[model samples]
Target: MNAAPADQIRLLDVQALDVRLSQLAHKRKSLPEHAEIDSLTKDLLQLRDLLVAAQTQESDTAREQTKAEQDVDQVRQRAVRDQQRLDSGAVSSPKDLENLQREIVSLAKRQGDLEDIVLDVMERRESLQERVGELTERVTSVQAKADIATARRDSATQELDDEAAAATKEREAVSAVIPADLLKLYEKLRVQQGGVGAARLFQRRCEGCQLELNITEVNAVRAAPRDTVMRCENCRRILVRTPESGL
Candidate 1:
């Protein structure tokens, strides 16, 4: 395929734009925030699990405390009724009075034990509450960091996307000027090779392959017509000649 010397130079501009787009894509993918967000997400998950467990324990302890307090109240009420009966002389028999007094003492001890249990349960609940609070704060802190990272990632991605969009537009405009056959050939070669479809021959070297052209290749290129489309023998990419091409 053949294109004018100027058209081949414009192809290089298209190639530059294509390379820029590729670099932007890579930058977007390799953004540091991506890894940061991933790490923060894992921490958040672990923290949330811990918070849930603590909260559950706290709730259970609260119910246990409530039950213990109820038992204490019930025992105290029974002791009050027994004391009233003994004071009213409702149990005339001396044995009955003694039994009533003994029952009152037992009820007091039971109430005291239940109260102790209630206190213990309250202490456990309080500790669990504190744990839940601490875990909640940790989760909040981690979530905030995650949010910031996501925002940074999104902002960086948007900037790169905008730049890539501009480069793509410019590439379309630049590539549009080339002959259809020549552009088609470049596109095919671009796919077959890496991202570089065309490279400049500079100072006797094919920049694509970074190798100096042999004497025979140099002579052949020197004799080629200015309007001829050239391909590098080493890399098989379109060899665009400029004044610096050292013949």
Candidate 2:
């Protein structure tokens, strides 16, 4: 493959733009906000799970408290009816009256026990309610942080994308004037050589492979025609010659 000396130099410009674009892509992927958002997302998931559990417990405790209160009310009602019967002399027999009084006392005791259970259930529900509230607040706070991180990541990505778009436009314009055969060769070598298709031979060294050309290689390059495109022996990349190539 052959290209004019000037065209080879412009290839270096294309290479520079490609390198810049690669760096920008790496920067976008490595943005700090990516890791931060990941961590925050984990926290949000755990907090949501805890909140759900607390809410469920609170609901269950509410039902338990209601059931206990109902038991207490039923026992108190029974005790009231027994006392009225005793006061009206409806039992008549002394033994029946004594038994009625004893039944009233037992009902009162049962009601008291049920009330205590209701109190215990109410306390647990209150604690669960407080826990749910705290977890919700934490979730909101973490979500806000994640939102900010996402915004930052998006803004950074947009800036890099804009810069890459500009570079791409410039590359298109620069690559347009080069001979199709030469550009095609460069593109092939670029794919084969890890993005560096062409390199300058500066001070007897191939910039692509960072290796100094030997005396034989230097002599051959010196004798080659100016319009000839050369490949580096070390790395098989297009070796572009410039005035500084210390032939």
The model with the greatest lDDT is 2
lDDT of 2 at 242: 91
Summarize candidate 1's per-residue lDDT along 1-247 as a digit string, tens digits: 6689999999899888988999999999999999999999999999999999999999998889888988998999999999999888779998988889999999988988888898889889999999999999999999999999999999999999999999989988888889998889889988888988999999999888899999999999999999999999999999999999998
Candidates in order have lDDT scores of 0.92, 0.93
Q: Could you tell me how far off, in angstroms, the CA of residue 129 lies in candidate 2 after the best superposition?
A: 1.3
Q: What is the lDDT of residue 110 in candidate 2?
A: 90
List the candidates' TM-scores in order.
Answer: 0.96, 0.94
lDDT of 2 by residue, 1-247 (tens): 6789999999999889989989999999999999999999999999999999999999999999888888888899999999999888778998998899899989988988888898899999999999999999999999999999999999999999999999999999999998888888889988999989999999999999999999999999999999999999999999999999998
Score candidate 2 by lDDT.
0.93
